[model samples]
Target: MRLVLRVGGLLIAICLVVACADATGVPGASGADVIFSDGFVPGQMGNWVIEGDNAGQTAVINEQLVFELADNNIMQFSTLPDVTFDNFILEVDAQLLEGDLGSSYGVLFRMQDSTRFYRFEITGDGLFMVERRDGESGWTRFVDRWTETPAIQQGLGSTNQLRVEALGTNISLYVNDELVHQFNDATYSSGTIALDAGTFVQPQAKVAFDNVVVRRP
Candidate 1:
């Protein structure tokens, strides 16, 4: 995962435009205003930078952060620039606009860099996995393969709410407010959080993310 890089801009040091009061009792969360939201200001992409195929673009459409990809075997991520965190809860809503059922899109938090990070990915086909990258060590799945989960809303054009909590050696995964899986790994203690999209056996996956909230315990 560390050796892999492409074109995608990461939004760091930004604020979540709208606050989600509903996240009151999220895991590892306490009452706080730790949120980063982006509706892509008109004419301004804020602090985000793009990396990947020229056919892809990131913009604000209909008050949502949109990531449009191309028909290529590639992955793109949007994250913060110079900020990092550990032991926090990150939440976001992802909608698959156009893509195959096998395509994947989700959040990546505690990202040490373009090479190292923890990824909580869910496919449009209703599969989810917890994995991470360690520099040149390559990709290692904490949950192993992309496991199918009833917690996810399967199929394209479906929107799913994803959340992850990283505390100490314990990590918790949630889908649509349901606790689906939880495990522990002390490999990464701190890094930046990000939203990512990828193409698996298929090509050209488009996923939109919104209402990103990060709370620290």
Candidate 2:
């Protein structure tokens, strides 16, 4: 499978650097140290990169950020290039509008660059996984494989609230506000974050994300 990393505010599939607009944060929950928040409304994409081709596309439409994958064995992601966080709690509502049941999508955090990052993703079939990418050194899975969980809503058109709480080497993952996994890894201490959608052997996955908020834990 091929993984596409949006590095340095540009889709790096062609190694082309594109200019990105600055992001503006919307007010978050009361009493929370909100760092970044976006409703994904038309012009609020800010530094989030949007790119697509015949293979797939990442766009903002109808007040939501959407990712469509037209090819199998490839993952496409978009990141906010201007902000970095060492520790924070990020939550986003993600739904599979239409796609293969084997398709997967979720959040990527502590991204050091195009080479390294941590991923928390769930399939359309109620399975979740946590993985780490260490450049050319290869990938490391925190779990053996996709683990089944009741926390995730199964099937397409089901919205799941994905949350990640990261502090130092400790990280926790939650689905639908229920804790699903937790672990510690010192590979990355501080970096930006991203949202991604991917497919396996089956393609045509359209995933939409909205109401993203990043705040202090």
Candidate 3:
């Protein structure tokens, strides 16, 4: 009977350790350390700002960044000291809130200014597009088509991964462990990286970013 108890205790201890490890392990693509993590606790606003045409319409729902189900679901971020990387990798996990059937959101890189940046967006319809906002040219579609999932498809509540790697003028993207998009643009070489909340109507949107690791090369 003593032996049985000892064995049972050992098994329990092992299970507890495994559970802890899983909880603490990095939540995304491997080999990345968490630099910034936000649970959206009130008064914890630092290094982040809510802007854009729909800023006031957005809020934190259950500690997640969420956009209301209203027309023109706009969201933006204007944190200073722009994260400039010469060569590095960035990954974020996001989910569009339910009811956002035709909305979109994604990451923006090389954002030198409001009018100069590259936006990698995933539509609520499950389509991915890469756009360039140049000073001379407005939002020009560099690549506007579906690569991961079809358009008008439901993605809210479904976690998707977005990755960007910048080495010189080469930019690559991966969605849910699949390589979906790649581009070579010489417009802007170095600038900040940001998350973009798009404009949609009555579309619920929420994004959770985890395992945001940056490796300099």
The candidate that wins on TM-score is 2
Runs with alpha carbons beyond 4 Å of true place in candidate 2? 1-32, 44-47
Q: Which regions in candidate 1 have their CA more than 4 angstroms from the true location?
A: 1-35, 38-46, 50-52
Per-residue alpha-carbon lDDT of candidate 1 for residues 104-195, written as tens digits (9 for 90 to 100): 77887777767788888888888887777776666777775668889888877777999888888898989999887887888888877777
Q: Model 1, poorest ten-residue lDDT window?
A: 11-20
TM-score order, best first, reads 2, 1, 3
Q: Against the true structure, whose lDDT is highest? A: 2
Query: At residue 70, what lDDT does model 2 achieve?
Result: 83
**TM-scores of the models, in the given order?**
0.80, 0.88, 0.68
Residue 82 displacement (Å), model 2: 1.6
Candidate 3 global TM-score: 0.68
How many backbone collisions does model 3 have? 6
In the order shown, the candidates' Cα RMSDs to the true structure are 6.9, 4.6, 17.1
Residue lDDT tens for model 2, 1-217: 2345442222323211121434443445335487777776666556555677888887788878888878766677777666789999999999988989878889989988756889999989999889898886767889887899999998889999999999999999999999999999998999888888877768688999888888897
**What value of lDDT does candidate 1 attain over all alpha carbons?**
0.67
